[model samples]
Target: MEKRRAALRLLPVLLGLALAPAAAPACEPALNGTRVESSRFVLSYQSTPIEVGKHFALDIAACSKPGAPEPESLKVDAQMPEHRHGMNYAAKVTKTGPQRWRAEGLLFHMPGRWELSFELRAGGTSDVMRNSLVVASAPVRFTEEEKRSILSHGPWPPKLVPDPSNRVSGNPEAIAFGERLFFEPRLSGTGSVLCATCHVPYRGFHDGRARGFGLEDVDRNTQSVVDARFNRWFGWDGANDSLWAQSIRPLLDPREMRSNATTVSRFIRNNPPFRTGYERAFGKKPPEDDEEVLVDVGKALAAFQETLVSGRTAFDDYRDALESNDVREMQKYPEDAKRGLKIFVGKGNCGLCHFGPRFTNGEFADTGIAFFARKGVVDPGRQGGIKKLRSSGLTLLGRFNDDPAQATALATLYVEAQHRNFGEFRVPTLRNVARTAPYMHDGSLATLRDVVRHYSELDEERLHGDGEKILKPLHLSEDEVSDLVAFLESLSAR
Candidate 1:
């Protein structure tokens, strides 16, 4: 029995040596297939790369050697030697000629070491030939289009441009003052809640909760402050055209800090540390007008928030490698991630909304998630945002804007609320997405997988009739779902 097992192990090697042409490279498949031979039979076969989760077929030609007894039949099969499990699907065999055959419907669903076995039987005895290979954990290759799409998500840490509407946007002194203001709990009505209370720096700058909790519950998810400098609009509803205006919102909201302009202005003017920082930032003491002081406070806070850019992620490394065609660096990225990225750029159509280096188009869309805040009240999303922007004095259209030309206010000047905008919400950056969970405007989904599943099984009936017809059910397989999640996780810092 031991001798027989040892002979079986040497069978494929012996057959390969006999069949390979004199000039052919050893242990490599030829253009058509790998050829093998033995004393009784000679066989040649070809197969595509045996990728996990993809269906493939095999072609084979076999015949008895001259002066050797002809085999009565041939059988083909495969198994994972360590796993002791064969393929889930059986191949359908077809005999095309006296010495040629085809096998269809072969599939490998898992990645690992696998062995393909070809058995030839004559009289009452059988000879089995086996070939072994490994299924890679990452994908084998990417199409040119796929490579292009993947490359577009990178270069990481986009250029920082000062806000034209806020004069102190790039001032180092203002940024320092802003940092102090960020952690100042006195800015809140409760004196215990700070901007850091909700936008926790250690927690990816957005408190990891389903909904933001300031003095009370906020209706939407607390988006990360990281990479906010790149946004065209702020907040889930796109309600604030400027980051400063958006900053002032939570300060006065009844459910948030609940501090009025008077409370905020007086606190900054009276508090020695704040007063000194404020003076340094603005080049003077706090102004007499309470509203002006409050706006300045928001501006200082915005200045601080602008610097919270996230670090480079694994995907960025892969993207850079791909851009330079560095095969060695690209291979360091997991194969599962590559497969997942293919789905993201191709079948998922996620790139349409989550585009650019920021991985967001900086716009709003109604993704068919329910918008009802309660049984009787619905969150009016972008519609409410445009309405609020039109009425707000903090906008670039207002006198508070430092820009004489109001150059940055174009989106504010022309944006009007439409019926289709009712459920539309701003697209958030995918940077640090894996860390900021409880996703969506309402924070309804709990995980990255949940968010993917939401799109995978989207209900078209719930979508706005007048909205862009981009979303539909993905109906992804289990492997596809896992692949997409892996890709999304790669977008985050390691």
Candidate 2:
């Protein structure tokens, strides 16, 4: 028991802790920036700013006094008390020479505060020293309800699932074929216009125009396809229920691809690679009827687009941390973002519609924005969408549906236009929203701040629904507005 007391280890209060230091042993070395001296051992280490979610190495030099016994071994490890968890991976310590050592495979998964400890043991005696590191991560703070609200937004980078309605949903062959067609301008009547011509990859898969320009200017803003698969309805007006049908609309719309079924089928049947890919994807030659051929092509395109989920963002990490009760990891999220998220979930009332993993309810809402397409033409919102859906032959309810039960048919079976839907548009997903800017259905909000401001100063009279009590002026201060915008930006993919 006396011998056990001699080997007793002491740890200094890390960061802001105020623990009493243990009486050090006789082997203390001169102190330096890279070196820490204790009574039983001297340890030195070198490292730069530690990065989160990545493995890193620490080169260490440790020694006992000249007359002292050599240590039997060294143990290295790390943990965060606030998070109530240790490193997801264990680091290996190796002796290089007389007193030189290296620790490898050290990683900080969630960033905030961490403690790295090194223990030197010899003949049942040990000495320990701890280094505090604040790994770089986006800092955030939250209230209890805010935590609950954020958690609802994810487990993110949502899983990709096959569309039951589209027979070629998850086929890699179909995805590759669709990818090729996406960049193929030849599918269009005008040779210069390709799907890629508007939905540029670098531009976050949005056309980057106020109104989409195809053969002629279209009335609505180009919605980005980053996580389109998760949506219940497609397009700004919620015109299409299935992504495949949604893809078909643009190909046939004169304002968009401006090509008929004959033109697209000709292109597919004439091109050897496309024809071969069509067969591989569909298990048959291209259909003779232009409409049948169009359906297959749309399915291929939807398969590829489903793979476009936004990468996990800072909000995802922070939300996860909060859910796991990791205080240290939660601290890494920016305070500004935290405040903004609070406003969004609470005072701002944005969550009424922008709720769920994709940050949208996948339903339509009237935000009271002006809907004028030009001088006198009105862009009738969901009402127009319903009329179009009912009148069109390209819907999930049509004979083109390969779905045996027509699983995507329920919404179609029940959907009907109402007077309240006159000015309502689909509630757009907010994932990667920072990159898809010029907000709202008309691209009327030039900036996200403008969108926030619009809600802050909304005109109740302009709202078409008399019973719609949700839209009211927020009267947010300038700082609150800034905070809200900051939170919204945290949703962008890193």
Candidate 3:
């Protein structure tokens, strides 16, 4: 039994030797049907039609020089010429007989002319042959449902409205003032950690930590501010209704800026640059109320942050290519990424919550991540968020809100926490997601693969009782997982 198993393992090799030619120009046997015959060997496969997106197989027979050692092995693969990409699925080759081989598991995903190539080897001799076939299928089409889903994620570089909640929202002078304040460290109680301390510019504005660090530590991971203006909710918990209000929480947090509203007010009021910038941006004088000044600072910070939108990504390029029906351009995108995208909107169901231009629906969900922050602490997530928003006087209900109609503030007024809100964190944007790691609200997962595996083999027991029922273990194959990760990484901004 052991000898038979060993022979089986070596079978492909032996078959290749039996068919390999002695010399590059050695005579090959004549054969018919979808074949390329050369002096060294004859390579042939079935002439059956290969419809795109459909799996098909054929016998790849080879005949070598008469005196050549029995062809040792045969290997077969296919590539789309225009796409310049190989088949997403690997082809399997097996020996059927002397100088005869069968290849299976061939699936051409795209419609285009394809090159079927073969490698034949015997002992130290080897030869290769190629045959071309135009494999095509029905023209590219998508259901109305799919088209809507795909289109919603784009219309890129969304129009910027610097600060809809504040009069300075789109003011250029305010933006400049805010830009200066963003890099100021004295604003923090530590007098060293700037806003850019956690939100580094080059690393896609992500601090790249499992949890953010400031004067002490931040419980959750630091989310990138790239394209942050699109987010209706702020923070992993959606604790703040506006970016301005969101900016204040970090400053007041003991672990973050560790500064009081009074201190922030004094610092800005005392600094000539800040005062001058503030006067030019918001008017001649800063607000007298300490708390009000602090709020204004947050607004300035928000103005600058809104400018940090992400640039175009590889996925964006591919999406544009698909839109224009530019086959040549589209082929440049990796097959792995395309397959991963199919899994994303299709089998993976990631598109449901991660939707829209920035790839988030701006909602919260309990996606099975643990809630514990410390030994006795548990994050109440969006539940806590709702409570905090309702009690905060700085909300849209307050005088700080510039929108008298309070259009964007309606969501806050209507929001109510239920059992489902517990453990729910905001859905983050997928743009530049590849640069922001480790992932998840808590950043417990270390890599994109780890996040994929977490969902692929989700722990049902850990999921919140009222969490999203749509989530389930994917049970994805290894290749599928790889493709999915590749696709997600493609979302990174250039």
TM-score of each: 0.80, 0.71, 0.77
Highest-lDDT candidate:
1
Q: Write the per-residue lDDT of candidate 3 for residues 12-104, one digit (tens) a residue.
A: 999999989875645443345576755566676774457766788877667765565666898888897776789888888888887777788
Candidate 3 versus the native: TM-score?
Answer: 0.77
**Model 2: per-residue Cα lDDT over 285-344, one tens digit each:** 987798899889999999999888899899999889888989899878887788788888
> What RMSD does each model have against the real structure?
8.8, 17.0, 12.3
Q: What is the lDDT of residue 125 in candidate 2?
A: 86
Prediction 1 global C-alpha lDDT: 0.86
TM for candidate 1 is 0.80
- Candidate topping TM-score: 1
Order of candidate numbers by lDDT, starting with the best: 1, 2, 3
lDDT of 2 at 310: 90
Residue by residue across 88-188, what tens digits does model 1's lDDT show?
Answer: 88878787676677788888877889888888787688878888878866454768987788888878877778999999999999999999999999988
